[model samples]
Target: MGWFLGLGIAGLVVLALSLVFDGVLEGVGGGLDGLLSLPVIAGFVSALGFTGALATGAAGAGAVLATLAGIAAGTLAGWATWSFSRALLRDGAPAPRGEDLTGTSGAVVTAIPAGGYGEVLLHLAGQPVKYAAKAAAPVARGAEVWVESVLSPTSVTVRPVER
Candidate 1:
């Protein structure tokens, strides 16, 4: 009982921490997966061996308390892993940030069709750029392409290229 309770408390603390660490506003998936590790957390706590001893310490009142705490801790760890994986790893094609067409590889989303309006995919940069690009041919939105030429501040011209 006591063991389960204590373990439970630990679990809840860890779970809550994981949630706050990888909240939605943080941008679903980029590189934050390294924070929470269930095995690491649980194994570390279990190593103390206090939980086991507490649960089975005396086979009397002590046993009941210890069992409770151990269960609590285990539950918390499970919850943490579940929450972190869901919030941080949402799957979606990463889109370009700004008009930064520098050193990136993306396909023309809106075919330049002409010049005033063409789309190119550059590896999304930290800061997104706001510019238009031109391409020789129509750069299909999903076409595999790269930034060929950067015209101006918010303007870039791109063409197809091999990966």
Candidate 2:
């Protein structure tokens, strides 16, 4: 095969490897994100490889530059792929309630101080979701609490969250 053709194949292989590792298209709201991710990454990565090959030719160092360029391109591709995969396989996406933390159930990890301080762990999507918890009634460690609402970035108000 011609140099350009071989280069094209190598570039594609790099891109695929990157996508398998990087995760550029994860959780893209599942619509346009799912459809357009591939073509976009492919076009961008191909352009990069083509440019690298051109640079290699101009420098009269085609063989060396081509190998290194393929490696670099593969690296970029891998990063994108990993990122996309992560988005697609998000572990515990925030409950679609937009932080409206009402009636969440968790077990208190520490005694809840009335003034505002504590910790709790609960299951959100089969994952251990821990949040700072506090309540009007003092809660002992291991006590069940209902997350009445989210009070701050790391905290939630609580009551009894009956099983």
Q: Tell me the number of clashing residue pairs for each predicted model.
A: 39, 21
Per-residue lDDT for 75 in model 1?
55
lDDT (10s digit) by residue, model 1, range 4-26: 44654665565466555545423
Model 2, residue 93: displacement in angstroms?
A: 9.6
CA-only RMSD, every prediction: 9.9, 10.7
Candidate 2 lDDT tens digits, 1-163: 1464455666577567756754466456375444335534554456456655665766655666666765576557646754776577687656644165566677888778776788898665557777887788778889988777777767778886545
**Which residues of candidate 2, in runs, are more than 4 Å off?**
2-5, 16-98, 114-116, 122-129
Worst 10 residues of 1 by lDDT: 39-48
TM-scores for the candidates = 0.36, 0.45
In terms of TM-score, the best-performing candidate is: 2
lDDT of each: 0.55, 0.65
